[model samples]
Target: MTVYLEDEQQFFEKHLGLLEKVEAVINQCLDQEEVPYEVEVSLTIVDKAEIQEINLEHRQIDRPTDVLSFPQIDPECIGKINWDNLDTSSCVNYDTEEIILGDIILCDEIAALQAEEYGHSLEREVCFLVAHSMLHLLGYDHMTEDDEKNMRQKQENVLQCLAILR
Candidate 1:
C-alpha cells in the first residue's frame, strides 16, 4: 500500500512520529482486508473548519467529524469482478500499477480533542482514526448494530495488532 499523505497544518510535526503511525495503520488495514491489488490511498489531515466544510459538502452534515472516507471501489464489485480479467480498469492508477483506493480526510483538531477526552496520546487517536477510515475504504461500514460492533472489533484489532494502544 502506498499512502500519499498531506498534513494541511503540519500537525504531524507537532505530534511526532505521526506519519509512520498512519502508514502502519493503512498497511495493516489493507493486509487485514486482503485487498487483491497494489493500492494507493490519499490521506489529508485538516483542521476543524476544513472538515466541517467537507462534511457539509460531501455528507450534507453541517458538523465537523473526526474522519471521512471516500472509497473508490464499489462493494458490489468486490466478489463478482475478476481481478485478472478486467480489460478496462477504471480504478487502476496505470502509472503506479495500483488500484486507487480513494481518499481519507482527517480532522486534526478533532483528533487532538478526542485524544484529550479519551485520555490517550494524539498519535493514538489519529492512528485509530486512520484504522477506522482504512476499514471504510476497504468497504467496511457501521450502518447497523452488528456492523458497528464488527467495525469496532476490526478497528481495535488493527490497533492492537500495530501495538498502538491507549
Candidate 2:
C-alpha cells in the first residue's frame, strides 16, 4: 500500500508523530484484509473551513464533518473485480502501477474536538477516522441498520488489530 499523505492544515505541522501512526494504522488495515493488488490512497488533513467547503461541494451539506471518503470503485462490485484480468484503461496509475483505491479527507479541527469530547487522545481519534475511511474505500457503508452494524464492527476490528484501543 502506498499512502500519499498531505497536511494542508498548519495544525498538523507539529503533529508529525501522530500522522505517522495514522499512516501505519491505514497500512495495517490493508495488510489485515489481505488485499491482492498494490493499492494507492490519498489522505489529506485540512482545516474545518476547507472541509466544510468540500462537504458542500461534494455532498451538498453545508457543514463540516470529521472525515469524508471518495472511492474510485463501487463497493458492491468489488468481489467481482478480476484483478488478474484488470483493464487498466481507466483506473490504473501509470507511474506507480497500482490501483487507485480512493481519497480520504480529514478535518483536523473536528478530529481534535471529537477526541476531547470522547475522552480519548487526538492520536486515537485520528487513527479511528483513518480506519473508518479506509473501510469506505473498500466499499463499506453504514446506510442501513445492518450495514451500519457491520461497518462499525469492521472499523473496530481494524482498530483493535492495530491495538489502537479506546
Candidate 3:
C-alpha cells in the first residue's frame, strides 16, 4: 500500500510513528476485506475553513466535517466489487500499477477539538478518522442501521488490530 499524506496545516504538531501506524491500519483494513491488489490512497489534512468549503461543494452542506472520503470505486461496484477480477484500466494507476483506492480529507482543527472533547490523544482520534474514511473508500457506508452497526464493528476491529485505543 502507498499512502500519499499531506498535512496542509502550517503549524501541525505530528506525533511520532503516526504515519507508520496509519499505514498499518489501512493495510489491515484491506487484508480484512480480502482486497487482492496493491493500493494507493491520498490523505490530506486541512483547516476548518477548507473542510467547510469542501463539505459545501461536495455534499451541499455548509458545515465543517471531521473527514471526507472520495471513493474511486464505481457506484455499481459498491458492495459487489470482484477482488479477483478488477478492471485495471479504470481502477489502477498506469505508472504505479497500484489500485487507486480513493482520497481522504481530514479536518485538523476539528480532529483536535474532538480529541480534547473525547479525552483521548490526538493520535487516536486521527487514526479513528482515518479508519472511518478508509471504510468508506472500501464502499462501506453507515447510512442504515445495520450498515452503521457493521461499519462501527469493522472500524473497531481495525483499530484493535493496530492496538489504537480510544
Candidate 4:
C-alpha cells in the first residue's frame, strides 16, 4: 500500500508516527486479506471548510464528514473476484510499478469533534477513520445492518492488529 498524504489544514499537529501507524494499519489489512495486487491510496487532510465543500459537491450534504473514499475498483474486481483467498506477496511486482487504488479525504475538524464526543484520543479516532476508509476502498460498505456489522468487524480486526482497539 502506498499512501500520499496532503495536509491542507494546520488544525492538528503533524505527527509522522501517527501517520505511519495509520499506513501500517492499511498495509496490514491488505496483507491479511491476501490481496494479490498492489494498491496506491491517497489521503487528503482538510479543515472544516474544505471538507464541507467536498461533502456538498460529492454527497450534496453541505456539511463536514469524518471521511470519504473514492474507490477505483471495477465490476470485475468485485463480481468475479475471489476475496476469500489471495496471495499477498504475489500481488505486486516491485520491478514494474503499478497502481491499484484511489484517494481518500479526511476532515481534521470533524475528527477532532468526534474524538471529543467519543471520549478518546485523537490518534485513535483518526486511526479508526483510516481503517474505515481503507475498508471502503476494499469494496466494503455499511449501508445495511449486516454490511455494517461485517465492516465494523473488519475495522476492529485491523485496529486490534495494531493494538489500537479499545
lDDT of each: 0.85, 0.82, 0.86, 0.76
lDDT per residue for candidate 4 within 53-136, as digits (tens), equals 988998899888899888666324422335445333444335545445667899888988999999988888999998888777
lDDT score, residue 75, model 3? 43
RMSD of 2: 2.0
Output the better candidate (3/4) by lDDT: 3
Q: Answer with 2 or 4, whichever has the higher TM-score.
A: 2
Candidate 1 lDDT: 0.85
TM-scores vs. true structure, each candidate: 0.92, 0.90, 0.93, 0.84
Query: Which runs in model 3 stand beyond 4 Å of their true positions?
Result: 10-13, 75-78
What alpha-carbon RMSD in Å does predicted model 1 have with respect to the real structure?
2.2
Give candidate 4's TM-score: 0.84
Q: Write the per-residue lDDT of candidate 2 for residues 1-166, one digit (tens) a residue.
A: 7888887775557786776788788787777666688889999989999999999999999999999999887643432344555665677799999989899999989999999999998888999999888888877777888878887787788788778888
Top candidate (TM-score): 3
- Deviating ranges (above 4 Å) for candidate 4: 10-13, 75-96
Tens digits of lDDT, candidate 1, 1-166: 7888788899878878779888988888877777677889999989999999999999999999999999887664322334455443778788889888899999988999999999998889989998988888777788888888988898999999999999
Q: Per-residue alpha-carbon lDDT of model 3 for 1-166, expressed as tens digits?
A: 8998788774244566777877888998898888888999999989989999999999999999999999988544435566666677888898999999999999988989999999998888888998899988888888889888888899899999888998
Instruction: Score candidate 4 by lDDT.
Output: 0.76
Error of 2 at 71 (Å): 0.5
Best-to-worst lDDT order: 3, 1, 2, 4
